[model samples]
Target: MTALAVRQIGPPRLTKGLESAGRLDWDAHRALHPHPRPLTTDQLIALCEAGSLHGRGGAAFPFARKVKATADSAVRRRKRTVVVVNGTEGEPGSAKDKTLLRGAPHLILDGAALAATALGSLEIIVAVTDPDAAASVQRAIAERGLGARARVVRLPERFITGEGGALVRGINGGRPIPPGRKSRASTRGVDGLPTLLSNAETYAQLAVLAGLGPHRYRKVGLPQEPGTVLLTVTGSARFPAVVETAAGAPLGHLLDLCGSRAGEGVLVGGYHGAWLKGEVATRTQVSRAGLAAAGGALGAGIVMPLGRGTCPLGECARVARYLAAESAGQCGPCRLGLPDLAGALTALASGQDAAAARDTVARAARMVTGRGACAHPDGTARFVLSAMDAFEDDIARHVADGGCGRPVLGVLPAATDARLSLEVDWSRCDGHGLCADVLRGTVRMDEYDYPVIPSEPIPARLEADARRAVAACPGLALRLVPRTAHDKPRPEPQRGR
Candidate 1:
C-alpha cells in the first residue's frame, strides 16, 4: 500500500504517456496512442506469434497460444469467451501490474477491449485487490464509455489470490483459492465460459503490439522475447522503484540504476523465486532464458537484493514462515509439509544443529514439491532451497559459531497481519501457566511459571487460540488489545515457586 517510484531504463513504451501524478485521462491516452484498427482473431494471433509477446504475470506463457486456445474453446463450446485482467498482485515483492493499473489504466483496458472484440466476447472483467487500482480502472472504464461491457471487481488480498485458477474462482463467486483439480482458464473460467485471463501488463503490451505491429514491436528487445519488461526493484536498494526496461537488459545495470551493489545476493521473481549469487546476478540478463541459465527465474519481475546488515538466513526463515502461514491448507503439502519446512529453516537460523536442520529442510522441501493443488508448495520449496545455497557461508558461520552477529533487519517484505496483541495484567495475576500452555508457540512460561508474553504482534492464525487463552484464564489476568496498547508498561511479576 506504499507509493512506488516509477522509472524507465530506456525508451518507454508501456509507460509512455504517464503524467506526473494521478491517472492519465482518456483524452491524453488517445493523443498518445490513437486506437488502431481492431485486429481480427487470426490477425491478433499472428501478430502475437510473430512478435513473441508472452504473459507478464510470472509464467511467461505465450499470448498467441492463449488467444488461439480461448478462441478455439469458445467456438467448440458455443459459449462466448470471457476476458479477465488480473491486477491482484498477491506477490508482495511485485508492483508492476498495480502500477500499470493506476498510471495507465486505459492502456490495459484498450488491450482487453481489443481482445474482447477480436474474440467476439461481450464481457471484460478487470479484477483488482488494491483499492487505488480498483478506483483507477473504474474511472477509466467510465471514461471510455465501456461501463456496460467492462467492469471492475475487487478481490481478497491474499498471496494465492493472483493465481490463474484462484482469480477466476474469485470472479465466479467462489472462495479465492486454487481449485482442487487443475483446469485451464481457457477451457472453463468466469461464468463457466471459456476465458482469456492475463496479467494487466500483458494486456497493455498487447495494446502496444496492436498499434505498433509485429515488426515495430520486435525492434526493442531480444529476437525471442521482444519489447520491454516492467520490474519491481526493491530491498537494500537506495531507490525502490517499478522500473521499465527492455528485455535482455543487463541485470547489473538495473541494480546500479536503483543504487544497489547486490550486498548479499539478489532475489529474483519474488518469494516463489530463486536467489542469485551477487556475482552471477551481476552477469545475468533480465530475461527468462538468461535467468534460467544462471540458476534463477524471471518470476513476476521482482528483484530484491539482501543487504549486508541483515542476516540472510534469518530473512529467509522469516519469509519461509510467512509462506507457511499463507498456505491455503487445501492439500497435504500445505497443511503439513510447509510448516515443517519453515520450522526447520527457523531452527537453522536460530543456531540449532546445522547438519540436521539442513537435512530436514531438504527432506521437507522434497516432500512438498509437486504435491500441492497449485505451485505454492513448489515455489516455497524453491525459495528456501535457493537461500540455503546462496547463503551457505553465513549458514556455516551460524553452525560453527553461534551466529553471523547480524540482526534480522527484515529488508525483504511479507504480508503480516499485526493488528492484535496479548496483554497480561500483572496486578491480578497468579503464576499460572495456562496462557503459555494454550498458546504454546507464542507464549512461554518463565522460571516461576508466570506467563512470558512476546512483544511481537500476534499472527492472524493464532488470534482464535489467543482469545480462548484469555477467556480460560482463572485469574482473568490476560486480554487481547490493539497492538499499540501492548507497549504500555505493566508491573513486574512477583517472583515465587
Candidate 2:
C-alpha cells in the first residue's frame, strides 16, 4: 500500500476507512472498472443525448455533442482515438478535480476507461498537477490493472496551464497555450487523432452509473443538476472544507457553510470568477446553475472566502493585473487588451474618476473583446467587470480617495510563475521618465504620475532594457527576484492587478 493510502483523515472514521464508503467497496474499486457497457455508435449517441450530460471541464459543453463529434471524426482516422481526463485544476481556488483524483481515483478511472471503450478507443490519459495527486492516481490505475489502458500524466504546476486547450498543448509537448482556431480536441488531440477530453470529476460521476444504474442515479439529483457535486470551500468562517452538496442546493445554506460577515466578500468562482458582496455571500447558494444564473459561473467548483481584513476592491484590482499577466500572449487582444484593463483598474483602485475608469474599460473591452484566439482576455475582463458591479461601494471609496485605509492583505493571487518583479516605489520615483523612455511598449508614463509596467514577462529583446530600468531607478525602488519571492501561494490565479 502507498504510504499515503487512507491517511490524513481528520475527524477520522475507521468505518468509512480513508475514503468515502458511499462510492464503492475498497476491493470492488480495485477490480477492473465497471463491466464495460459496450454500445453501438447510435446507441451511445442516444444515451448521451438522453442524459444531457455536459462537459464537466468548466465549459459545460454537451457531452452527447462532444461524443458525436469525436466518434464521427475518429471513425475513419488512422490514429487511434484517445480520451483525456483533465485533472489540472488550474483555477486559483478550485479543487474539485484534485479532490476526486486524490480521494476517488478509481472512480475517475472507471469513467475514463468506460468512455474510451464506448468511443471504441484504447488510449486513456489522466493529467494532474500535484505530486501527491499524481502518485495517488498512478497507484489507483495500477491497482485496478487499468494502467495498461490509461496513462497518468503529471503536468507543470501553473494555474492557467490546466485549461482545456493548454492541457492539449501540454500533452503535445508544447508550452500550455490556447490554439489559434477552432482546434477541437476531437480533431487534432494527442497527435492529430480524434479525442474526448473532460474534467476528472466528470469521470467519477460516470462511475456511479455502473453500480447505481441510470434510473437509480437519476433519483438523487434534480433534472438540471442531476448529480452530487463537490466544492472546495474557503472563507472567513471555519476550516477549509471540501463539501459535497446536491446540485442546485439553495445558496442560502451554502452561505451558512461559508458564513456571513460585513466588509468581507467571496470570490465566487476563482481568479476568473466574480466577487459576491457580503449580502450575496450571505444569501448565495452553491451550484453551477445557481451561480451561473446569478451572473457568475463557478469555474470548476472553486469558492474563496474573503476575510474581513483586506479591502475588497484593492484585493480585486491586485488580482486583475495578475490575471492579465498570466495571459498566454498567443492572442493579441488578451496580450494587449488585458494589460490595459488591468492598469485602468489599478488607477481606479488608487482613486481616479470612476466614470473615467469605466470609459477606459469600455475602450479596452472593445479592443480585446472578440479579438482573442482564446478566452483569456474575455474571461479576465468578465471578472473585472463583474467585480465593478458587485463591489460598487468599495470601488467608489477607493476611487474617491487616493488610498483605502485597509491594507492590501494579499488576499488575491499573483500571476508571475516565479515571483520576480521590477517594483517601483512611487515615493522614490520622481517621475524621471527614463524608465518609460527605455521600456516603451512594456512600461509607460501615467496621468497621475507613475511608471506603469505594461507587461510582466520581460521578452528577451526588452529584457536588457527592463534590467536597465531596474538599475536606473534612482530610488532603488526597482528590484527583481523570482515571482514567488514573497513566499506566499498566490490565490490560484488572482494575482495583483
Cα lDDT tens digits for candidate 2, 161-202 = 777778898988898777777678887788778888888877
Candidate number with greatest lDDT: 1
After TM-score superposition, the amount by which residue 1's alpha carbon in candidate 2 deviates from its true location, in angstroms, is: 24
Worst 10 residues of 2 by lDDT: 1-10
Candidate 2 off by > 4 Å? 1-44, 235-237, 259-265, 281-284, 352-355, 423-430, 434-465, 471-477, 482-497
Candidate 1: deviation at residue 143, Å? 0.7
Clashing pairs in 1: none
Give the least accurate 10-residue stretch of model 1, judged by summed lDDT: 488-497
Clash count for candidate 2 is 21
The TM-score, computed over Cα atoms with residue i paired to residue i, of candidate 2 is 0.83
lDDT of 1 at 60: 90
